[model samples]
Target: MPALQYWSFLVAIGVLVIAGGIFAGLTIGLMSLDETNLAILKLSGTVEEKAWAARIEPIRRNGHLLLVTLLLANTVINETLPVLMHSLKWDGYKAVLISTALIVVFGEIIPQAICARYGLQVGAFFAYPVRILIWVVYIIAYPIARLLDWILGHKHGVIYRRSELKELMALHGEDQEGPLTKDEVSVLRAVLELRDKSVLNVMTSLEHVFMLPLETKLDRPTMENIMKAGHSRVPIYASDRGCIIGVVLVKQLIINDPDDAIPLSDIKIRRLPRVTARIPLFEMLHVFEQGGSHMAVVYDSLPGQTEQPGESSRNGEALARIVQPTWTYASPRQADSSGGNVLGIVTLEDIIEELLGEEVRILGSTLRACVRVYMEITGRL
Candidate 1:
């Protein structure tokens, strides 16, 4: 009977100690999860993918509940662990030492190490139980959650802001297990900045863009440029750049009206969506998608204001630009907002490149190889 009593206390200590580890591990695992990937999975994924996203979503959103649960539960177990060992009829000092070692090793170091590297896995394993635990603890922790909401000014389902995301990426750049390459890290940084980058910086200025008036007779030069239009799409203006009506597909010149090419006025013209120059590229993408247009007219400011090309445009040239301009020329760099020139034109390709990483153009074939070799030698890549 005495042996059974001792063993029962021993079992109690073991269970409580291990439970503490799980709680601690859960805290680390959920905290370290990649909320971005989880969100993508939530938006467009299979059933299993969506399930995983659903399970993890709460852990990311209700961080307050989990932290409170872990803190309170771990604290109680750590404090009670020694007392239970003493009840096993052991020496008081020996019981204290044993409890401390178990809590520190099993409950802290082991869980932290495992969770830090394999957080998503650890989080998945505990998500179901932790979700229930959160609900159960909600009654107990509601005040704390409310206090945090008051302090943080809650926004639903927003795990991290853009600035916080940048800091976190930088913090993990030096991770030892599977460090990201410099290029990979830089691309990730650019991705976070997409929402901050305005359309003005990336759009093709109206001057550089190929456009023609509705009433123009296809003169020899216009015919030549249309026959060899360097771009896929060309904007057609009614009277001036300000009166841009719709775009023409270069392929349409050859493909339409086999007898004698359809006139520019008769070409199928999709409605061109208007985007403010100040709108972030990422936000503009949503508008583009919803509008089902690959290209949008970008304004320098707002409607009825000066809409001129941005200073950063590669094709900036100051002029009236009313001359039968070739594809090589852009609008005047100094045009005022009232003149009706668009700040630039944003294409789907430009936004895609900005999101994925822009390609760096290298001049001279030999120089490209030289730069590659220099990067390898200097480890500057």
Candidate 2:
């Protein structure tokens, strides 16, 4: 067996190989982490991850510099290995083979494998030493780093688009060990899509919405019908179905004597906010939040859109019985004069349903479901 002339030379060879491995590992590992990954970790990562990110961030920020320093150190250490092997009483050809095997297996492949999987932790642990290496190699590495920066321009961090974020959420949902459940991912994806949707997508069409004629009386039967309708608020129309006046709260009508029936005009009618169908759901939500109104009339404002000539009916039946008005409470903001054909009605529940990716149930929703079933059975919807 070929033996080394001095054991001290063998120790020097081991040190060089280890140093080469560290340099190779740092190059692949630390460089993989870009600005955005670091930022996300700092903000939402686990405690250990946050600490690791904080340690690595400052060093990784200067991408070109860190890259050049690590690569240069690794190259130099690899070059010195064969020379050290030759000095240890090894023939030139055997030394070359030995050095190549050591560099490929220990210095490159093994270290790179470990670093790729646990880069953040590894990089953080070696951050201080890497900083010192950068300083030591600054004179040579600085020029090359500057040239790269000038050629490539500064690196801009990754910013995900709405669709990209949805894809990412889907990926997370696929991971069994991930924090988000499938339903949670679906809801989050819906939230990101809210800015793309409008009231037109969620509104109950005008012909399907329940309303009351302004002249309708709150007799015992009518009160019972209104309660059975299950709406917290009901729109009041005047002259015709197109002429929506305002809305009256179901709770407000409870104080009236059922025996002594009162007209809708006799009660306080709150103004219904109006919105264009083209407005995004997010903007519509902001409108509802600011105005403190749970309901709004969706309208089509496109020029030359003609009004369909028919009284609005729900599920092939008139929701409110038409009778001559004893009194009319006409607000200046009535729907008929609002410069658009009423398309439908949208409520807070509609937006919430969109966000939740499911239909929301309110008090009278069960009755509405039955009505939908009835309509479907009769083929009137």
Best by lDDT: 2
Clashing pairs in 2: none
| Residue 103 lDDT, candidate 1, scale 0-100 | 90
The backbone clash count of each candidate, in order, is: 6, 0
After the best TM-score superposition of candidate 1, give how far the Cα of residue 199 lies from its true spot, in angstroms: 7.0
What's the residue-level lDDT of 283 in candidate 2?
A: 65
Worst 10 residues of 1 by lDDT: 318-327
Candidate 1: clashing pairs of residues: 207-329, 207-330, 207-331, 208-330, 306-337, 307-337
Q: Write the per-residue lDDT of candidate 2 for residues 207-325, one digit (tens) a residue.
A: 98889888888876676676667787898888777677778877677666665788777787877666667667776675565445688777777343222213232221221121111
TM-score of each: 0.53, 0.83
